[model samples]
Target chain A: MEDVLKIGGKEIKSRFFVGTGKFPDKAVVRDVLEASAAEVVTVAVRRVDPDSSDENILDHIPERCVLMTNTSGARDAAEAVRIARLAKAAGCGDWIKIEVINDNKYLLPDNKETIKAIEILAEEGFTVLPYMNPDLVDARRMVDAGAAAVMPLGSPIGSNRGFRTEEIVRIMVDEIKVPVIVDAGIGAPSEAARCMEIGADAVLVNTALSAAADPVKMAEAFSKAVEAGRSAYLAGIPERIEEASASSPLTGFLR
Target chain B: MTLKINGKEEILEKEMTLTGLIKDKGLNGRNIVIECNLEIVPRQTWGKVDVKDGDSIEIISFTGGG
Candidate 1:
């Protein structure tokens, strides 16, 4: 998996990036991270109130995982840029998960706004990973706009719907030059594995691990599944066919 | 008095309710769920749920998003 994912000019060791939120406690979060072995962890800036002293998830995450800050609350390009700068100022890191979700419910990124933000962020020299749907044309535009990587969702965020659009994702893997990280709506480990098997460089998980009865174990599960899937993909999966290929087109009349 | 939230101490002028705490901190309550002393703070009770001294408060906010 280390060789599989590269983003922000840095190589990530694992494909499954875990979120630090929703754990029972920091201890549990630590346990889950240790279990999942996620090299990169997705953490949002707005949640940690530095001044208040009551809300910081800083302790829960151990010293090992690389923190990937998010612009989860930003409504537009300007706001996303502002948040990115703030995150940099806050010493969060240069690698940012730019989520330009305007609507509140579905949390879907508005394509127009997200593109604008990605452009600005890229120009500012930030390693931008903009979350996008399974749209290859848009992904091409983003890659040209200087995005470090394009994170196309396998399904809706936290819906755990799995890779319902596997073909489009495969096309994305084929078309894009940068890493194709599958983000959101992953319900189970099998789904995560499937994404990795399909050639996703990495995947981000939150609700599934957070909401689980035992998050640490579940994190470990996601880790193993991703590794296994990646291994399977690398080892080469068997060809699929509706029926047997009887040397029709190329071999025309060999028989 | 110092209030224990996520294992940190904070001094406040008066007893704070979850809603007041949320508003004072300027956090988006919809994206976060608050728990005090291991009890889930219900939406209806968020406004009235009082915080006292030495309460082990935990507030979890979803960050990976949506």
Candidate 2:
């Protein structure tokens, strides 16, 4: 069965969401994007000179992919709102990934500020996806505030620590009404697959792919792993047991 | 007259429209947003709005990030 991932009234063919940061070069970005077959990609906005005819990052992204702009530098809701408005005004799209981080040490997201940004952006018809700590109450609040999806971090951003918050993310995946996308600190394909196996709607990977020896090949690996895990989940794996249970009968062979 | 653009001071020969400044900087003004004096200048108003002496303008564009 071919299952489609839908976000904000649009049908997405791929469950993998890739970030276009930390790549060796723009060429690698295009190659990895094409290889991953991801329909959603994240971008950040920053100051630019108008007179300089520099190659814009917008030009690197293909038209088929949805550009999900993020408010990465915003420390509070007001700043996030401002960035979101600017992103929309720039003709990027209505998709905004609300990332509000006040913690400088760990770069942990401020859940309250994220929810605040979501409430405002959602009122303006923007599809809001808030990056949040794996908190049940905040996840519920984000849903109530019209978040299109809840992105709970597995660990700190770019830490390469896999599934450090697995239990909490599992709770979010189980309880949230919207899609639970496991983002950040996912270092390997197996970790991403594990997330899918636990019923996560998707996983956002950046560091693991970009930091690999060959980003394009790693992107392909991740895509396949995501598909494999999703299929396994759909097919329903058997539950684990403490004691040994023989797959073959104990007395039936040659007796 | 002088204006601070993207944190750099530049002498303005005459009053320049926001659109003119954008074009003078070699940007086509698409896929970018401009803010003048802490307020977002809509694309439509870029032509009508004029940059005054000591005006601070910030121009921003999308970049690859997570």
The numbered model that scores best in lDDT is 2
lDDT of 2 by residue, A149-224 (tens): 9999989999989878889888888799999999898999999999999888999999998899999999999999
Each model's lDDT comes to 0.77, 0.90
Alpha-carbon interface RMSD of model 1? 10.5
Model 2 Cα RMSD, 1 decimal:
1.7
Using Cα atoms with residue i matched to residue i, what is each candidate's TM-score against the true structure?
Answer: 0.74, 0.95
lDDT against true structure, model 1: 0.77
DockQ of each: 0.08, 0.81
Query: Cα deviation of A240 in candidate 2 (Å)?
Result: 0.7
What is the Å distance of residue B47 in model 1 from its true position? Answer: 36
Per-residue lDDT of candidate 2, residues B1-66 (tens digit):
988888999898977798888778777777889988888888888899999998898898988898
Tell me the spans in candidate 1 whose CA falls farther than 4 Å from its real position: A1-4, A47-53, A243-255, B1-66
- Residue A68's C-alpha lDDT in candidate 1? 74
| lDDT score at residue B21, model 1, on the 0-100 scale | 82
Worst 10 residues of 2 chain A by lDDT: A49-58
